[model samples]
Target: MRIIGLLLLTGSLTMGLAACGGGDEQSTAKQEKAVETSTEAKAGVEEFTITAKNWNFSSDKEIVVKKGEKVKLNLVNKEGLHTIKNDELGIDLTADKPAEFMADKTGEYVLKCSTVCGATQDHEGMEISLKVVD
Candidate 1:
Protein backbone atom coordinates (compact mmCIF):
# COMPACT_ATOMS: atom_id res chain seq x y z
CA MET A 1 0.00 0.00 0.00
CA ARG A 2 3.05 2.29 0.39
CA ILE A 3 3.64 2.22 -3.37
CA ILE A 4 -0.01 3.09 -3.94
CA GLY A 5 0.24 6.14 -1.62
CA LEU A 6 3.45 7.30 -3.37
CA LEU A 7 1.73 7.11 -6.76
CA LEU A 8 -1.17 9.21 -5.51
CA LEU A 9 1.18 11.81 -4.09
CA THR A 10 3.17 12.12 -7.32
CA GLY A 11 0.00 12.45 -9.38
CA SER A 12 -1.33 15.28 -7.20
CA LEU A 13 2.03 17.12 -7.37
CA THR A 14 2.04 16.90 -11.18
CA MET A 15 -1.46 18.31 -11.38
CA GLY A 16 -0.61 21.14 -9.01
CA LEU A 17 2.42 22.11 -11.09
CA ALA A 18 0.34 22.18 -14.26
CA ALA A 19 -2.26 24.37 -12.63
CA CYS A 20 0.40 26.81 -11.42
CA GLY A 21 1.84 27.12 -14.91
CA GLY A 22 -1.57 27.95 -16.38
CA GLY A 23 -2.18 30.53 -13.65
CA ASP A 24 1.19 32.17 -14.35
CA GLU A 25 0.39 32.43 -18.06
CA GLN A 26 -2.92 34.11 -17.34
CA SER A 27 -1.30 36.51 -14.88
CA THR A 28 1.31 37.50 -17.44
CA ALA A 29 -1.36 38.21 -20.04
CA LYS A 30 -3.31 40.35 -17.59
CA GLN A 31 -0.15 42.30 -16.72
CA GLU A 32 0.51 43.02 -20.39
CA LYS A 33 -3.02 44.32 -20.86
CA ALA A 34 -2.69 46.65 -17.86
CA VAL A 35 0.57 48.05 -19.19
CA GLU A 36 -0.98 48.72 -22.58
CA THR A 37 -3.92 50.53 -21.00
CA SER A 38 -1.67 52.79 -18.93
CA THR A 39 0.45 53.65 -21.95
CA GLU A 40 -2.62 54.63 -23.90
CA ALA A 41 -3.83 56.83 -21.05
CA LYS A 42 -0.50 58.67 -20.82
CA ALA A 43 -0.29 59.07 -24.59
CA GLY A 44 -3.68 60.74 -24.56
CA VAL A 45 -3.73 64.54 -24.71
CA GLU A 46 -3.11 66.35 -21.42
CA GLU A 47 -4.55 69.74 -20.49
CA PHE A 48 -3.81 72.52 -17.94
CA THR A 49 -5.79 75.65 -17.19
CA ILE A 50 -4.64 79.07 -16.03
CA THR A 51 -7.05 81.73 -14.90
CA ALA A 52 -6.67 85.49 -14.88
CA LYS A 53 -8.07 87.37 -11.92
CA ASN A 54 -8.24 91.09 -11.27
CA TRP A 55 -5.36 92.56 -13.29
CA ASN A 56 -2.99 89.62 -13.02
CA PHE A 57 -2.92 86.01 -13.99
CA SER A 58 -4.18 84.26 -10.89
CA SER A 59 -1.99 81.56 -9.46
CA ASP A 60 0.93 82.69 -11.55
CA LYS A 61 3.13 79.76 -10.69
CA GLU A 62 5.53 77.36 -12.22
CA ILE A 63 4.20 74.63 -14.48
CA VAL A 64 6.18 71.52 -15.18
CA VAL A 65 5.92 69.30 -18.22
CA LYS A 66 7.71 66.39 -19.73
CA LYS A 67 9.66 66.61 -22.96
CA GLY A 68 7.94 65.36 -26.12
CA GLU A 69 4.53 65.63 -24.51
CA LYS A 70 1.50 67.45 -25.93
CA VAL A 71 -0.09 70.02 -23.65
CA LYS A 72 -3.34 71.94 -23.98
CA LEU A 73 -3.30 75.19 -22.03
CA ASN A 74 -6.59 76.92 -21.38
CA LEU A 75 -6.38 80.51 -20.22
CA VAL A 76 -9.44 81.89 -18.50
CA ASN A 77 -9.46 85.63 -17.97
CA LYS A 78 -12.10 87.38 -15.94
CA GLU A 79 -10.58 90.68 -16.92
CA GLY A 80 -11.36 91.78 -20.46
CA LEU A 81 -7.84 92.87 -21.37
CA HIS A 82 -5.30 90.30 -20.28
CA THR A 83 -2.78 88.37 -22.36
CA ILE A 84 -0.34 85.58 -21.62
CA LYS A 85 2.83 85.15 -23.63
CA ASN A 86 6.09 83.30 -23.50
CA ASP A 87 7.93 84.78 -26.45
CA GLU A 88 11.06 82.76 -25.94
CA LEU A 89 9.06 79.55 -26.21
CA GLY A 90 6.70 80.86 -28.87
CA ILE A 91 3.67 80.52 -26.64
CA ASP A 92 1.10 83.27 -26.72
CA LEU A 93 -2.16 83.63 -24.81
CA THR A 94 -4.29 86.31 -26.31
CA ALA A 95 -7.13 88.27 -24.81
CA ASP A 96 -10.43 86.41 -24.40
CA LYS A 97 -8.86 83.23 -25.82
CA PRO A 98 -6.93 80.18 -24.77
CA ALA A 99 -3.41 79.31 -25.88
CA GLU A 100 -1.67 76.01 -26.53
CA PHE A 101 1.97 74.99 -26.65
CA MET A 102 3.95 71.77 -26.72
CA ALA A 103 7.09 71.11 -24.69
CA ASP A 104 9.83 70.30 -27.15
CA LYS A 105 12.84 71.01 -25.01
CA THR A 106 13.80 70.36 -21.39
CA GLY A 107 14.39 73.59 -19.52
CA GLU A 108 12.81 76.36 -17.52
CA TYR A 109 10.73 79.02 -19.31
CA VAL A 110 9.37 82.26 -17.99
CA LEU A 111 5.79 83.20 -18.86
CA LYS A 112 4.92 86.87 -18.75
CA CYS A 113 1.97 89.09 -19.45
CA SER A 114 2.13 90.68 -22.90
CA THR A 115 -0.65 93.25 -22.61
CA VAL A 116 0.08 96.37 -20.66
CA CYS A 117 -3.29 96.47 -18.98
CA GLY A 118 -2.00 98.08 -15.80
CA ALA A 119 1.21 98.85 -13.94
CA THR A 120 3.77 96.26 -15.11
CA GLN A 121 4.30 95.45 -11.40
CA ASP A 122 2.27 93.84 -8.66
CA HIS A 123 -0.41 91.87 -10.48
CA GLU A 124 0.22 93.48 -13.85
CA GLY A 125 3.89 92.64 -13.89
CA MET A 126 3.28 89.05 -12.73
CA GLU A 127 5.11 86.16 -14.37
CA ILE A 128 5.32 82.42 -14.00
CA SER A 129 7.93 79.76 -14.67
CA LEU A 130 7.64 76.43 -16.43
CA LYS A 131 10.00 73.51 -16.25
CA VAL A 132 10.26 70.92 -19.00
CA VAL A 133 11.87 67.59 -18.36
CA ASP A 134 12.53 64.42 -20.29
Candidate 2:
Protein backbone atom coordinates (compact mmCIF):
# COMPACT_ATOMS: atom_id res chain seq x y z
CA MET A 1 0.00 0.00 0.00
CA ARG A 2 2.82 2.45 0.86
CA ILE A 3 4.55 1.63 -2.46
CA ILE A 4 1.34 2.34 -4.35
CA GLY A 5 0.98 5.77 -2.73
CA LEU A 6 4.63 6.67 -3.53
CA LEU A 7 4.18 5.66 -7.17
CA LEU A 8 1.04 7.79 -7.55
CA LEU A 9 2.83 10.81 -5.98
CA THR A 10 5.81 10.41 -8.31
CA GLY A 11 3.60 10.14 -11.36
CA SER A 12 1.67 13.26 -10.43
CA LEU A 13 4.90 15.23 -9.88
CA THR A 14 6.29 14.12 -13.22
CA MET A 15 3.13 15.18 -15.06
CA GLY A 16 3.14 18.55 -13.31
CA LEU A 17 6.74 19.20 -14.21
CA ALA A 18 6.11 18.30 -17.85
CA ALA A 19 3.21 20.71 -18.08
CA CYS A 20 5.24 23.52 -16.52
CA GLY A 21 8.16 22.93 -18.88
CA GLY A 22 5.96 23.07 -21.94
CA GLY A 23 4.31 26.28 -20.78
CA ASP A 24 7.69 27.84 -20.13
CA GLU A 25 8.91 26.97 -23.61
CA GLN A 26 5.85 28.54 -25.21
CA SER A 27 6.18 31.65 -23.10
CA THR A 28 9.82 32.02 -24.05
CA ALA A 29 8.99 31.75 -27.73
CA LYS A 30 6.35 34.46 -27.45
CA GLN A 31 8.73 36.76 -25.60
CA GLU A 32 11.40 36.33 -28.26
CA LYS A 33 8.95 37.18 -31.01
CA ALA A 34 7.85 40.31 -29.20
CA VAL A 35 11.45 41.42 -28.83
CA GLU A 36 12.09 40.93 -32.51
CA THR A 37 9.04 42.99 -33.43
CA SER A 38 10.06 45.78 -31.08
CA THR A 39 13.55 45.91 -32.52
CA GLU A 40 12.23 46.13 -36.07
CA ALA A 41 9.94 48.96 -35.11
CA LYS A 42 12.76 50.91 -33.50
CA ALA A 43 14.88 50.85 -36.59
CA GLY A 44 13.88 53.95 -38.58
CA VAL A 45 14.56 54.20 -42.29
CA GLU A 46 14.79 57.15 -44.69
CA GLU A 47 14.15 56.79 -48.40
CA PHE A 48 15.19 59.02 -51.29
CA THR A 49 14.49 58.81 -55.01
CA ILE A 50 16.89 60.20 -57.61
CA THR A 51 16.15 60.26 -61.30
CA ALA A 52 18.88 60.15 -63.91
CA LYS A 53 18.49 61.48 -67.41
CA ASN A 54 20.70 61.63 -70.48
CA TRP A 55 23.47 63.86 -69.17
CA ASN A 56 22.62 64.47 -65.49
CA PHE A 57 20.39 63.67 -62.59
CA SER A 58 16.98 65.31 -62.74
CA SER A 59 16.46 65.23 -58.96
CA ASP A 60 18.21 67.08 -56.23
CA LYS A 61 21.94 67.56 -56.49
CA GLU A 62 22.47 66.65 -52.82
CA ILE A 63 20.71 64.33 -50.41
CA VAL A 64 20.85 64.92 -46.68
CA VAL A 65 20.19 62.36 -43.99
CA LYS A 66 20.82 61.83 -40.32
CA LYS A 67 23.79 59.87 -39.15
CA GLY A 68 23.10 56.36 -37.94
CA GLU A 69 19.81 56.30 -39.84
CA LYS A 70 19.02 53.63 -42.38
CA VAL A 71 18.94 55.01 -45.93
CA LYS A 72 17.22 53.55 -48.97
CA LEU A 73 18.32 55.07 -52.27
CA ASN A 74 16.40 54.45 -55.45
CA LEU A 75 17.78 55.32 -58.85
CA VAL A 76 15.30 55.83 -61.68
CA ASN A 77 16.68 56.06 -65.20
CA LYS A 78 14.49 58.43 -67.15
CA GLU A 79 16.44 58.60 -70.38
CA GLY A 80 19.47 56.28 -70.52
CA LEU A 81 21.12 53.54 -68.58
CA HIS A 82 23.51 54.79 -65.95
CA THR A 83 25.32 53.58 -62.86
CA ILE A 84 26.57 55.53 -59.84
CA LYS A 85 29.04 54.31 -57.26
CA ASN A 86 30.75 55.65 -54.17
CA ASP A 87 33.52 53.63 -52.56
CA GLU A 88 33.51 55.44 -49.23
CA LEU A 89 29.89 54.78 -48.39
CA GLY A 90 29.69 51.50 -50.32
CA ILE A 91 26.94 52.86 -52.57
CA ASP A 92 26.22 51.37 -55.97
CA LEU A 93 23.07 52.70 -57.62
CA THR A 94 21.92 51.44 -60.98
CA ALA A 95 18.77 51.56 -63.06
CA ASP A 96 18.02 47.95 -62.34
CA LYS A 97 18.50 47.77 -58.55
CA PRO A 98 18.35 50.04 -55.54
CA ALA A 99 20.84 50.50 -52.70
CA GLU A 100 20.30 50.41 -48.95
CA PHE A 101 22.70 51.06 -46.07
CA MET A 102 23.12 52.75 -42.73
CA ALA A 103 24.54 56.26 -42.81
CA ASP A 104 26.93 55.76 -39.95
CA LYS A 105 29.57 58.27 -40.97
CA THR A 106 28.96 62.02 -41.11
CA GLY A 107 30.53 63.51 -44.19
CA GLU A 108 30.08 64.33 -47.82
CA TYR A 109 30.09 61.40 -50.21
CA VAL A 110 30.26 62.03 -53.94
CA LEU A 111 28.41 59.57 -56.16
CA LYS A 112 29.61 59.67 -59.74
CA CYS A 113 28.58 57.81 -62.83
CA SER A 114 30.66 54.67 -63.34
CA THR A 115 29.20 53.71 -66.69
CA VAL A 116 30.23 55.35 -69.96
CA CYS A 117 26.97 56.43 -71.58
CA GLY A 118 27.88 59.38 -73.80
CA ALA A 119 30.60 62.02 -74.25
CA THR A 120 33.46 62.21 -71.80
CA GLN A 121 32.38 65.59 -70.51
CA ASP A 122 28.80 64.51 -69.87
CA HIS A 123 29.77 61.40 -68.00
CA GLU A 124 32.45 63.24 -66.07
CA GLY A 125 30.08 65.96 -64.94
CA MET A 126 27.30 63.60 -63.91
CA GLU A 127 27.48 63.34 -60.14
CA ILE A 128 25.55 63.74 -56.91
CA SER A 129 26.44 64.32 -53.29
CA LEU A 130 25.20 62.63 -50.16
CA LYS A 131 25.57 64.46 -46.88
CA VAL A 132 25.20 62.78 -43.53
CA VAL A 133 24.73 65.04 -40.53
CA ASP A 134 24.38 64.50 -36.83
Candidate 3:
Protein backbone atom coordinates (compact mmCIF):
# COMPACT_ATOMS: atom_id res chain seq x y z
CA MET A 1 0.00 0.00 0.00
CA ARG A 2 2.85 2.40 0.79
CA ILE A 3 4.56 1.56 -2.53
CA ILE A 4 1.38 2.30 -4.46
CA GLY A 5 1.00 5.65 -2.66
CA LEU A 6 4.63 6.55 -3.38
CA LEU A 7 4.21 5.65 -7.05
CA LEU A 8 1.08 7.81 -7.34
CA LEU A 9 2.80 10.79 -5.67
CA THR A 10 5.81 10.47 -7.96
CA GLY A 11 3.61 10.23 -11.04
CA SER A 12 1.71 13.38 -10.07
CA LEU A 13 4.95 15.29 -9.39
CA THR A 14 6.40 14.19 -12.73
CA MET A 15 3.31 15.29 -14.60
CA GLY A 16 3.28 18.68 -12.80
CA LEU A 17 6.94 19.25 -13.54
CA ALA A 18 6.54 18.37 -17.22
CA ALA A 19 3.57 20.73 -17.52
CA CYS A 20 5.46 23.69 -15.98
CA GLY A 21 8.59 23.31 -18.15
CA GLY A 22 7.81 26.23 -20.57
CA GLY A 23 6.16 23.95 -23.16
CA ASP A 24 3.44 26.59 -23.66
CA GLU A 25 5.97 28.97 -25.25
CA GLN A 26 5.54 27.23 -28.60
CA SER A 27 1.76 27.55 -28.43
CA THR A 28 2.05 31.20 -27.47
CA ALA A 29 4.29 31.84 -30.45
CA LYS A 30 1.75 30.17 -32.74
CA GLN A 31 -1.06 32.34 -31.33
CA GLU A 32 1.00 35.49 -31.88
CA LYS A 33 1.62 34.44 -35.47
CA ALA A 34 -2.11 33.85 -35.98
CA VAL A 35 -2.89 37.36 -34.72
CA GLU A 36 -0.29 38.84 -37.04
CA THR A 37 -1.79 36.93 -39.98
CA SER A 38 -5.29 38.20 -39.16
CA THR A 39 -4.08 41.80 -39.13
CA GLU A 40 -2.30 41.31 -42.44
CA ALA A 41 -5.40 39.81 -44.02
CA LYS A 42 -7.56 42.79 -43.05
CA ALA A 43 -5.01 45.20 -44.49
CA GLY A 44 -4.83 43.68 -48.00
CA VAL A 45 -8.39 44.18 -49.21
CA GLU A 46 -10.56 46.97 -50.79
CA GLU A 47 -14.34 47.23 -50.50
CA PHE A 48 -17.47 47.90 -52.62
CA THR A 49 -21.22 47.55 -51.99
CA ILE A 50 -24.21 46.27 -54.03
CA THR A 51 -27.86 45.83 -53.22
CA ALA A 52 -30.29 43.17 -54.52
CA LYS A 53 -34.08 43.24 -54.19
CA ASN A 54 -37.38 42.33 -55.92
CA TRP A 55 -36.96 41.43 -59.63
CA ASN A 56 -33.92 43.62 -60.42
CA PHE A 57 -30.48 44.64 -59.25
CA SER A 58 -30.18 48.05 -57.67
CA SER A 59 -28.24 49.13 -60.72
CA ASP A 60 -29.74 47.88 -63.96
CA LYS A 61 -26.23 47.15 -65.30
CA GLU A 62 -23.08 45.34 -64.25
CA ILE A 63 -20.46 46.97 -62.10
CA VAL A 64 -17.32 48.04 -63.95
CA VAL A 65 -14.10 47.41 -62.06
CA LYS A 66 -10.46 47.78 -62.99
CA LYS A 67 -8.12 44.82 -63.32
CA GLY A 68 -5.81 43.77 -60.47
CA GLU A 69 -7.97 45.51 -57.91
CA LYS A 70 -9.37 44.02 -54.70
CA VAL A 71 -13.16 44.35 -54.73
CA LYS A 72 -15.32 43.67 -51.72
CA LEU A 73 -18.68 43.09 -53.44
CA ASN A 74 -20.90 43.89 -50.50
CA LEU A 75 -24.27 42.48 -51.49
CA VAL A 76 -27.33 43.38 -49.46
CA ASN A 77 -30.18 40.89 -49.71
CA LYS A 78 -33.54 42.53 -49.05
CA GLU A 79 -35.48 39.28 -49.50
CA GLY A 80 -34.08 35.75 -49.98
CA LEU A 81 -30.79 33.80 -49.99
CA HIS A 82 -29.03 35.11 -53.07
CA THR A 83 -25.69 33.98 -54.48
CA ILE A 84 -23.25 35.08 -57.18
CA LYS A 85 -20.94 32.78 -59.13
CA ASN A 86 -18.60 33.46 -62.05
CA ASP A 87 -15.88 30.85 -62.03
CA GLU A 88 -14.45 31.75 -65.44
CA LEU A 89 -13.96 35.44 -64.70
CA GLY A 90 -13.01 34.71 -61.08
CA ILE A 91 -16.10 35.80 -59.20
CA ASP A 92 -17.64 33.58 -56.53
CA LEU A 93 -19.88 35.63 -54.25
CA THR A 94 -22.71 34.95 -51.83
CA ALA A 95 -25.45 37.39 -50.90
CA ASP A 96 -25.97 36.05 -47.38
CA LYS A 97 -22.94 38.06 -46.29
CA PRO A 98 -20.85 40.71 -48.01
CA ALA A 99 -18.78 38.96 -50.68
CA GLU A 100 -15.25 39.84 -51.81
CA PHE A 101 -13.48 39.18 -55.10
CA MET A 102 -10.37 40.36 -56.90
CA ALA A 103 -10.41 41.57 -60.48
CA ASP A 104 -7.32 39.75 -61.64
CA LYS A 105 -7.77 40.28 -65.36
CA THR A 106 -9.24 42.83 -67.77
CA GLY A 107 -12.33 41.58 -69.59
CA GLU A 108 -16.09 41.69 -69.77
CA TYR A 109 -17.51 39.01 -67.47
CA VAL A 110 -20.92 37.66 -66.47
CA LEU A 111 -21.83 37.43 -62.78
CA LYS A 112 -24.94 35.49 -61.82
CA CYS A 113 -26.63 34.32 -58.64
CA SER A 114 -25.92 30.61 -58.11
CA THR A 115 -28.83 30.08 -55.72
CA VAL A 116 -32.00 29.44 -57.70
CA CYS A 117 -34.60 30.51 -55.16
CA GLY A 118 -37.54 31.12 -57.49
CA ALA A 119 -38.71 30.80 -61.10
CA THR A 120 -36.15 30.11 -63.86
CA GLN A 121 -38.19 31.34 -66.83
CA ASP A 122 -37.32 35.05 -66.75
CA HIS A 123 -34.71 34.88 -63.93
CA GLU A 124 -36.89 36.93 -61.60
CA GLY A 125 -35.28 37.98 -58.30
CA MET A 126 -31.76 37.22 -59.57
CA GLU A 127 -28.84 39.23 -60.86
CA ILE A 128 -26.41 38.56 -63.72
CA SER A 129 -23.38 40.20 -65.40
CA LEU A 130 -20.53 42.30 -64.05
CA LYS A 131 -18.14 43.97 -66.49
CA VAL A 132 -14.46 44.10 -65.55
CA VAL A 133 -12.30 46.58 -67.44
CA ASP A 134 -8.61 47.27 -67.68
Candidate 4:
Protein backbone atom coordinates (compact mmCIF):
# COMPACT_ATOMS: atom_id res chain seq x y z
CA MET A 1 0.00 0.00 0.00
CA ARG A 2 2.83 2.48 0.79
CA ILE A 3 4.47 1.86 -2.58
CA ILE A 4 1.18 2.37 -4.42
CA GLY A 5 0.54 5.72 -2.67
CA LEU A 6 4.05 6.98 -3.60
CA LEU A 7 3.53 6.10 -7.25
CA LEU A 8 0.18 7.95 -7.34
CA LEU A 9 1.74 11.07 -5.82
CA THR A 10 4.57 11.02 -8.37
CA GLY A 11 2.16 10.69 -11.25
CA SER A 12 0.03 13.56 -10.00
CA LEU A 13 3.09 15.81 -9.69
CA THR A 14 4.22 14.98 -13.21
CA MET A 15 0.82 15.76 -14.69
CA GLY A 16 0.62 19.06 -12.80
CA LEU A 17 4.05 20.11 -14.03
CA ALA A 18 3.10 19.25 -17.60
CA ALA A 19 -0.06 21.27 -17.35
CA CYS A 20 1.88 24.32 -16.09
CA GLY A 21 4.37 24.07 -18.92
CA GLY A 22 1.58 23.91 -21.49
CA GLY A 23 0.02 27.09 -20.08
CA ASP A 24 3.37 28.88 -20.31
CA GLU A 25 3.74 27.83 -23.92
CA GLN A 26 0.33 29.18 -24.76
CA SER A 27 1.12 32.50 -23.09
CA THR A 28 4.37 32.82 -25.01
CA ALA A 29 2.59 32.19 -28.28
CA LYS A 30 0.05 34.89 -27.52
CA GLN A 31 2.81 37.38 -26.74
CA GLU A 32 4.58 36.65 -29.99
CA LYS A 33 1.38 37.08 -31.95
CA ALA A 34 0.76 40.47 -30.31
CA VAL A 35 4.24 41.65 -31.23
CA GLU A 36 3.76 40.64 -34.85
CA THR A 37 0.48 42.52 -35.04
CA SER A 38 2.05 45.65 -33.60
CA THR A 39 4.86 45.54 -36.13
CA GLU A 40 2.48 45.15 -39.01
CA ALA A 41 0.40 48.13 -37.88
CA LYS A 42 3.45 50.36 -37.63
CA ALA A 43 4.76 49.25 -41.01
CA GLY A 44 1.73 50.62 -42.84
CA VAL A 45 1.97 54.09 -41.29
CA GLU A 46 3.79 57.01 -42.96
CA GLU A 47 5.26 59.84 -40.89
CA PHE A 48 5.98 63.42 -41.99
CA THR A 49 7.15 66.58 -40.28
CA ILE A 50 5.95 70.10 -41.13
CA THR A 51 8.03 72.96 -39.83
CA ALA A 52 6.26 76.22 -39.06
CA LYS A 53 8.25 79.42 -39.35
CA ASN A 54 7.58 83.12 -38.92
CA TRP A 55 5.36 83.52 -41.99
CA ASN A 56 5.20 80.17 -43.71
CA PHE A 57 5.82 76.49 -43.41
CA SER A 58 9.47 75.72 -44.05
CA SER A 59 8.61 72.26 -45.29
CA ASP A 60 7.13 71.36 -48.63
CA LYS A 61 4.45 73.65 -49.99
CA GLU A 62 2.58 70.65 -51.28
CA ILE A 63 2.60 67.64 -49.00
CA VAL A 64 1.67 64.70 -51.14
CA VAL A 65 0.67 61.21 -50.04
CA LYS A 66 -1.14 58.21 -51.39
CA LYS A 67 -4.81 57.73 -50.70
CA GLY A 68 -5.96 54.96 -48.36
CA GLU A 69 -2.68 55.21 -46.44
CA LYS A 70 -2.16 56.06 -42.81
CA VAL A 71 -0.45 59.42 -42.30
CA LYS A 72 1.13 61.02 -39.27
CA LEU A 73 2.01 64.72 -39.47
CA ASN A 74 4.14 66.27 -36.79
CA LEU A 75 4.24 70.04 -36.32
CA VAL A 76 7.54 71.71 -35.48
CA ASN A 77 7.64 75.38 -34.59
CA LYS A 78 10.88 76.98 -35.75
CA GLU A 79 10.17 80.70 -35.46
CA GLY A 80 6.68 81.40 -34.18
CA LEU A 81 3.64 79.83 -32.65
CA HIS A 82 1.36 78.56 -35.36
CA THR A 83 -1.54 76.26 -36.05
CA ILE A 84 -2.73 74.62 -39.24
CA LYS A 85 -6.23 73.51 -40.07
CA ASN A 86 -8.15 71.96 -42.92
CA ASP A 87 -11.88 71.53 -42.54
CA GLU A 88 -12.31 69.12 -45.39
CA LEU A 89 -9.51 66.80 -44.37
CA GLY A 90 -10.40 67.12 -40.66
CA ILE A 91 -6.91 68.17 -39.75
CA ASP A 92 -6.07 70.57 -36.92
CA LEU A 93 -2.37 70.79 -36.23
CA THR A 94 -0.79 72.78 -33.46
CA ALA A 95 2.68 73.46 -32.15
CA ASP A 96 2.04 71.19 -29.20
CA LYS A 97 0.17 68.34 -30.89
CA PRO A 98 0.42 66.24 -34.03
CA ALA A 99 -2.19 65.28 -36.61
CA GLU A 100 -2.87 61.69 -37.60
CA PHE A 101 -5.39 60.36 -40.07
CA MET A 102 -5.98 58.06 -42.98
CA ALA A 103 -5.82 59.68 -46.41
CA ASP A 104 -9.13 58.46 -47.70
CA LYS A 105 -9.94 61.07 -50.34
CA THR A 106 -7.89 61.96 -53.39
CA GLY A 107 -7.87 65.71 -53.78
CA GLU A 108 -6.03 68.89 -52.96
CA TYR A 109 -6.92 70.20 -49.51
CA VAL A 110 -5.73 73.65 -48.42
CA LEU A 111 -4.12 73.96 -45.02
CA LYS A 112 -4.23 77.45 -43.60
CA CYS A 113 -2.81 79.01 -40.51
CA SER A 114 -5.56 79.36 -37.90
CA THR A 115 -3.65 81.70 -35.62
CA VAL A 116 -3.14 85.38 -36.39
CA CYS A 117 0.54 86.23 -36.49
CA GLY A 118 2.44 89.36 -37.52
CA ALA A 119 0.63 91.31 -40.26
CA THR A 120 -2.23 90.51 -42.59
CA GLN A 121 0.02 89.66 -45.51
CA ASP A 122 2.08 87.29 -43.45
CA HIS A 123 -0.97 85.42 -42.31
CA GLU A 124 -2.44 85.33 -45.78
CA GLY A 125 0.49 83.52 -47.25
CA MET A 126 0.69 81.01 -44.43
CA GLU A 127 -1.05 78.35 -46.42
CA ILE A 128 -0.02 74.98 -47.73
CA SER A 129 -1.56 72.27 -49.84
CA LEU A 130 -2.13 68.68 -48.80
CA LYS A 131 -2.38 66.65 -51.98
CA VAL A 132 -3.74 63.13 -51.76
CA VAL A 133 -3.34 61.02 -54.86
CA ASP A 134 -4.07 57.49 -55.98
Question: Per-candidate TM vs. native?
Answer: 0.57, 0.64, 0.54, 0.65
Candidate 2 regions exceeding 4 Å error are 1-43, 60-62
lDDT of 4 by residue, 1-134 (tens): 99999999999999999887866458545644543454466777766667778887855334788999988666766667899998888889885576889999999888888999889998989987788999
Give all candidates' CA lDDT scores. 0.66, 0.77, 0.62, 0.77
lDDT of 2: 0.77
| Residue 81 alpha-carbon offset, candidate 4, angstroms | 0.5
Better of 1 and 2 by TM-score: 2
lDDT of 1 by residue, 86-131 (tens): 8767788753354666789899987777767666565455666678
lDDT of model number 4: 0.77
Give the per-residue lDDT digits (tens) of candidate 3, residues 1-134.
99999999999999999888875466545544543454466765655445555554564234777788776665555555666777885566654455567788777766676777678853543655566677
Q: Rank candidates, TM-score, best first.
A: 4, 2, 1, 3
Whose lDDT is higher: candidate 1's or candidate 2's? Answer: 2
Ranked by TM-score, the better of candidates 3 and 4 is 4
Q: Is candidate 3 or candidate 4 better by lDDT?
A: 4
- Please count the clashing residue pairs in each candidate, in the order shown: 0, 0, 0, 0
* Each candidate: RMSD: 17.2, 16.2, 12.2, 14.6
Error of 2 at 60 (Å): 6.1
List runs of model 3 lying over 4 Å from the truth.
1-46, 59-62
